[model samples]
Target: MARNTIRKDENTTRRSKKELILRLSVYLKPYKKESAIVIGLMLFVMLCSVLNPYLLEIAIDDKVANHDVMGLLEIGGVLLVLNLVAWAVSIIRWKKIYSINNNILLNIRRELYTHIQDLSFDFFDSRPVGKILARVVGDVNALKNLFNQSIQLLIPQLLNLALLSIAMLMLNVKLALVCIALLPILAIAMFCIEIFSRRRWEIYRKKRSNLNAFTHEEFSGVKVVQSFAKEKDTNDEFKHFVKNLKKSWNSAVRLNDMFWPLVELSAGIATVIVFSVGYKLVISGEIAIGTLIAFSMYAGMFWRPIMNLSSFYNTLVTNLSAADRIFDILDVKPDIKDAEDAEKMDKINGKVEFKNVGFAYEEGADVLRDVNFNVEPGERVALVGATGAGKSTIVSLLSRFYDVTSGEILVDGKDIRKVKLESFRNQMGIMLQDTFLFSTTIMENIRYGRLDATDEEVIAAAKAVDAHEFIIKLEKGYDTEVNERGSRLSLGQRQLVSFARALLANPRILILDEATSNIDTQTERLVQRGIEKLLQGRTSFVIAHRLSTIRDCDKIMVVEGGRIIESGNHDELITKRKAYYGLYSAQYEFLNEGA
Candidate 1:
C-alpha cells in the first residue's frame, strides 16, 4: 500500500508539472510580438559573438602579421562597433523582457486570486488560510525567475551555441568535429544531473511550503500562544520545521552545486583537446595560425553555452516544483458556480425557503438532513441548537455559501442556483460571530459594505446601528485605525462596526450567526437595540447560543443531530414545555446564579 501511495504521488507530480508547463505557456502567447523582438535581438547578439573571434583571426593573420597597421586599426574599429551594437541590442531586449515577465506574473497572480474568490466556502474550510496564502504569495513568486532566465539566459545561450557551431565548421572542419564529439558526452552528463536532481528540488519546495504555512499560522495566532504561555513549545515546533527545511535545502543545493563544476570540467577538457589537436594541425600546415587561434576561442564560446544550459536545467527543476504547487490550486474546480443559463436576479422580496435541504462537508457525515423551513419577506427567525447541531450550516446554506446536497434554496420564489452568483449574493448580507475588520480606519471598514457608499450614507448606516455615538467618542472618531482583525477595538465595538457594515449593505436578506454571543450583557443591550432596528422590514436569520436573545424572534428553531426537532414561536414552545422550554429554563437558572 505504501509503495502504491508513493507511485501515485510520483504520477501526480509528473502530471502536475506537465500541466504547469502547458498552462504557463499560454501567458506567453499574449507577448508574442515582444518575444519575437527579443529572439531577433538575441540572434543578433549571437552573430556578434561568432564574428568577434573570426574578426580576430583576420586581424592577426591578414592585418597584424602582415604589418598592415591601417588595416589592423580598421579591423579594431569594426570590432568596437560590433560590441557597441550588441550592447545596445542587449539593453532594449532587457527592458522588453522585464516588461513581458512582470505583466505575465501580474496576470497569473490576479487569475489565482480571482479563482480563489470564486470557490465555495467549503474549499476554504478544508485548507488553512496560511496554506492558501503561501500559494498566492510565495509559490506564485517562483515563476518570476522562470520567465526572467528563459529569455535572458536560455534562448541566448542556445542561439550562441548553434551559431558558434556553424562558425567553427566554416573555419576548420576537423576542430568542429572534435567539438561535436564532446557534446554527446556533455549532454549525457547534464541529462543525468537533471534526472537525479528533480526529486531533491521537489522535496526542498515542499519543505519551504510547510515552513511558510507554519510561520503564517503561528504569527497570526501569536496572542493565543502568548496567552497560553506556549511560547517555548511553539518555538520548539518552529525550530523543527526550520531544521527540516534546512536539510531539504542542503540536499537540493548540493545536487545543484555539482552541475556547475561538472560543466566547467567538461569545458576545460574540451579546450585542452582543441589545443592539443589544433597545434598539431597548425604544425602540419593543415590550418593557419590565426585559424587555430580562432578555433580555440570558438571552443571556449561553445562550452560557455553548455555551462549555461546545465545551469538552466537546474533552475528548471527548482521552478517546476513551485509551478506544480501553483497549478494544484489553479486546477481545483470551484465547488459552487452558477448554471450555464443562469439568469440575473436583481430585486428580491426577501422570501427564503428550504425545500428538504440536506448538506454535509464530508460524505456520510451529514450536517443537515431533510431540513424544510420558510420565512416571510420580513420575518426574524432564530436558529437555536447545541454545538454541532448545524445552526450555522443552515445559515450558510441560506446565504448560499455552500449549495444544498439534496434539495433547493429559493429566494422570492426563484432557485438561487439558477441566479447569477454576484447578483444573488449582492442582495444578501451575512455577519458571523467573529466580526472581522481590516487593518484600516473605522470609516473605511464600514464603507467596505458598499464601496461606492457616500460618506453621509456611511454615517447614516452607523447611526442606524447605534454605533455613531461610540464612533464620535473615539480618539479619531470614524477615522480611527482599527488594528488587524479589529484588535484595537473592544469585542462589542467590533460587533457594532460590523453591524454598521451589514446595515450599509442594505441587504434584503440578513443572516447573523452568533452575532451577539461575544458581547457583555451591558453591551448586548446596547447592540440589541441596533439589532432590532436592523432586523426591521428585512428577512433575517439569527443563530444564537443565548436563548434569551431569540425569545422575541418570530420563530425559534431547535436543531439536533442534523434535524429540526422543534420549531415554533417562543410562547408556543414554552407552552409545550418540551426541548425549547428545558433550554430556556436551564438558561434562566444559569443567569440567575450569575446574578
Candidate 2:
C-alpha cells in the first residue's frame, strides 16, 4: 500500500499543462461574478496609475516651464488629491478581492471535504489519508494565491500596459510604435518560460503532496517502525523523497529566475532605441526637453507593467496546476450513491437475507460465490472460517460497505440498494478487531457512536462493558485525552471502549469481527458478558477466532473457501464431527494441553 501511494504521487507529478489549466478554469466558475468585480477594480487602479505619469508631464511642460507658480500649485494640489484617492481605492480593492478569494477557497475546501466523505470505502482503501489532506490544504492554498495575487496583479498590470501605450502614442507616435514593437518579442520569451515553468511547478506541487503523505504514514505507524527497528530505513526513504522535492523546486525556480532578467533585457533594448530617436528629434527642435523626459519615463513605466503581467502569468500557470489536483478529487464520482427514489427507514426489524450472493474485488476471482443465508430478528449467527475465507466479506456485504457483484441483500424484504445509505448504516453497529479512536477524551470517543448520547448514558455504557473502572482511574476520568488512535490505552482497554461505544449506539443489528481478539482472558470474559447483553434484543453476526466465543450462538456456520461446509448449533455441529467439530476439537485440545 505504501509503495502504491508513492507510485501514484510520481504519476500525478507528470500531468500535462493543458489538463491542469482546464481543470482550474472549472473551479473558478463558481466565483466568476466576484472575480469580474476584482478585475474591474484592478483595471481602474491601473488607469489611475498610468494617468499619474501624464499628469507629471503636464505639470512639467505647462506650469514649471512657463514659471506659472499658481498654475504649478493648482496642478500639484490636484495630483496630490488624485494620488490619495488612488491609494484609498487600491486598498479597498485589495480588501474586497482578498475577501472574495478567501470565501472561494473556503467553498472549494468545503466541497472537497464533502466529496471525500461521500466517496466509497473502496476509494478510501486505495488512497492515503495524508495524501487527501495535502490536496485539501496544500493544493488549495496554491489555488488561493492564483485568485488573490496572480489574477489581481495580472489584470491591473495588463491594463497599465494598455493605458501607457495610448499615452505614449499621444506624446510621440513613432517612439510609441518602436517601444510597442519590442513587446511581442518580450511576450514570446515570457510564454516560452511560462510553458517550462508550468511543467516544473506541477512536479514541485506533486512532490510536496508526496512528502506530506510520507510524513503522515510515518507518524501514523511510528510505533511499528520503532518496534521493528526500521527508523533508519524510514529516514533514508524520506531523505530520498526530499531529494526529489529539492530537484523539482530548483528546476521551477531556475526557470522563473530567468524571467525577470529577460524582461529587463527587452526593456533595456527598447529604452536605447527610444533615447536614440528622441535625441535626434530634440536636436531638430521637433520636441521639447520636458516632452522628451516625460516620454522616457512613461516608456519605462509601460514596460514595467508588462514585466509584472508576465510574472503574473507565470504564477497563474502554477496555481492552475494546484487547482487541477483539487478539482480532480471533486470530479471523482462516488461509486456508491443514493438511488433517485431511495427511502429512509425509521424502524428496523433486523432480519437480513443474502440471496444468490456472488462477489469479487476484481475480475476472474470470486470471494463469495452463490452464498445464501438468512438471519431472523434477535438471532446471533457465528461465521467461522480461516483467514481468506468469506467470513469478513459476509459482514462487509451485510453493512453494504461494498455491494455484491451479483446478488440482492434485503433488510426486511426491502432491497438495501433502494434504501438511503445513511439511514441504512444507522441501523447497525460494527466493532472491528482493530478499533479506531480519535485523539479526544474517552467521553467524546464513546459519544462518537451516538453523538446525542448524554454523559450519564456514556458512563452507564462504559460500566456495562467493564471499561468504567479503568476510565475513571485516569487522571481526568472521561475527559482524559486518548491521544492519536488511543495510544494511551492498552489493546484490551481499547477493545472495551469500542464495546461500550457499540452498546451505546443501541443499534438493531450488531457486528463483531473478532472483536475480543485483543483482550486478555480476564478482560475477554467481561467483554463476552457485555456482548451477551448488547446482543440480547439485536440480531448479531460474530466473526470469531476463538471457537469458545461462538459456542452458544444460535447458529454456527463453518465456511471454507467461500462455501459453508457445516451449519448448526454448537452441540449439533460438534456431534456431527464435521468441519466445525474438527475446529472446536483442535482448539479445545490446545487449551487443555496448555493448561
Candidate 3:
C-alpha cells in the first residue's frame, strides 16, 4: 500500500509539472513578436562572437605577420565596429526579454489570484491562509528568475554554442572533433546533477511554505497565546520550523552549486586538450597559425555557453516546483457554482425550502443528514441547538455557500441550483458570527452592503439597527476609521456595525447567525428592539444561544444529531415538554443562578 501511494504521488507530480509547462507556454504565446526580435538580435550577437576571433586570425596571419600595417589597422577598425554592434544588440535583447518576462509573471499572478477568488469556501476551509498567500506572493515571485534566465541565458547560450561549433569545424575539423568528444561527458554529468537537484529544491519549497503557514497562524492568534501564557511553547515551536527551513535550504543550495564547478572543470580540460593537439597540427603544417589560433578561441567560446546553459537548466528545475504549486490551485474546480443554462432569478419572495437535503464535508461523517424544513414568506424562524448540531450548516446551504451533497434547496419553488448565483444571493443578506470589517471608514464599510446606497440611505439603515447612535458618538461619527476585522472597535460595536451593513443591503431574506452574541444583556435589549423592527417584513433565520432572545420568534426549531426533533412556536414547544422543554428549563435555571 505504501509503495502504491508513493507511485501515485510520483505520477501526480509528473502530471502536474507537464500541465504547468503547457500553461506557461500559453502565457508566452502573446509575446511571440517580442521573442522573434530577441532571437534575431541573439543570432546577430552569435555571429559577432565568432567573427571577432576570425578577425583576430586575419590581423595576426595576413595583416601583421605579412607586415601590412595598413591592413591590420583596417581589420582592427572592423573588429571594433562588430564588438560595439554586439554590445548594443545585447542591450536591446535584454530590454525586450525583460518586458516580456515581467508581463508573463503579471499574467500568471493575476490569473491565479482571480481563480482563488472564484473558488468555494471549502477550498479555503481545507488550507490555511498562509499557504494560499505563499503561492500567490512567494511562489509566483520565485518563477521570475526561471522565465528571465530561460530567455536571457538559455537561448543565447545555445545559439552561441551552435555558431561557435560551426566556426570551429570550418577552421579545423580535428580540434572540433575533440571538443565534441568531451561534451557528452559534461552532458552526462549535468543530467545526473539535475536529477538529484530537483527533489532537494522541491523539499526546500515545501519547508518554506510550512514555515510561512505557522508564522501567519501564530501571529494572527497572538492574543490567545498570551492569554493562555503559552508564549514559551509557541516560541519553541517557531524555532523548530526555522531550524527545519534552514536545513532544507542548505540541502538544496549545496547540490545546485555543483553545476558551476563541474562545467568549469570540463571547460578547463577541453581547453588543455585543444592546445595539446593543435600544437602538433600547427607544427606538422596541417593548419595555418591563424586557423589554429581561431579554432582554439572557438573551443573556449563553446564551453562558456555550455556552462551558462547548464546553470539556466538548474534554475529552471528549482523554480518549476513553485510553478507546479501555483498550477495546483489554478486547477481546483469551484465546489459551488451556478449550473450551465441557469436562469436569473426574479425578486426573492423569501420562502426557503429544504427537501431531504444532506451534506458532509467529508464522504462519511455527515454534519446534516436527511434534513427537511420549510419557512413561509416573511416569517421569523429561529434555529436553536447545541454546538455542531448543523444549525449554521442549514443557513450556509440557504446562502448557497456550499451545495448540498444530496437532494435540493429551493427558493420560491425554484431549485437554487437552477438560478444564477449572483441573482439569488443579491436578495439575501447574512450577518456572520465572526464580524469582519475592512480597514476603512465605518460609513464605507456599511456602504459596502450596497455600493449604490446614498449617504442618507446608509444613515437610515444605521438608525434602523440603532447603530447610528454609536457611530455619531465616535470622533468622526460614521466617517470614523476602523481597522481590519474591526479590532479597533469593541466586539459589540463591531457586531452592530455589521448589523447596520446588513440592514443597508436591504435583503429580502436575512440571516443572523449568532449576530447578537457579542452584545451585553443591556445592549442586547436595545439591539433586540432594532432586530424586531429589522425583521418586520423580511424572512429571517435567527440562530441564537440565548433562548430568551428567540421567545418571540414566529417558529422555533430544536435541532439535534443533524435532524430537527421538535419544532413549533415558543408557547407550543413549551407546552409539548420534550426536547424544547428540557433545553429551556436548563437555560432558565442557569440564567437565574447566574443572576
Model 2 lDDT-worst window of ten = 1-10
**On residues 69-147, what C-alpha lDDT tens digit does candidate 2 reach at each position?**
9988987888788778878877887888878778878888898999999987877777777878888999888877776
TM-score, prediction 1: 0.96
Overall local distance difference test of candidate 3: 0.86
Which parts of model 3 have CA positions greater than 4 angstroms off? 1-12, 16-19, 475-479
lDDT of each: 0.85, 0.84, 0.86
Give the residue spans of candidate 2 off by over 4 A.
1-3, 7-10, 13-41
lDDT of 2: 0.84
**TM, every model:** 0.96, 0.94, 0.93
Which residue pairs come into collision in candidate 3? none
Ranking by TM-score: 1, 2, 3
lDDT of 1: 0.85
Predicted candidate 1, C-alpha RMSD: 2.8
Cα lDDT tens digits, model 1, 454-525, are: 999999999988899999999999999999999999998999999999999989999999989788988887
Best by TM-score: 1
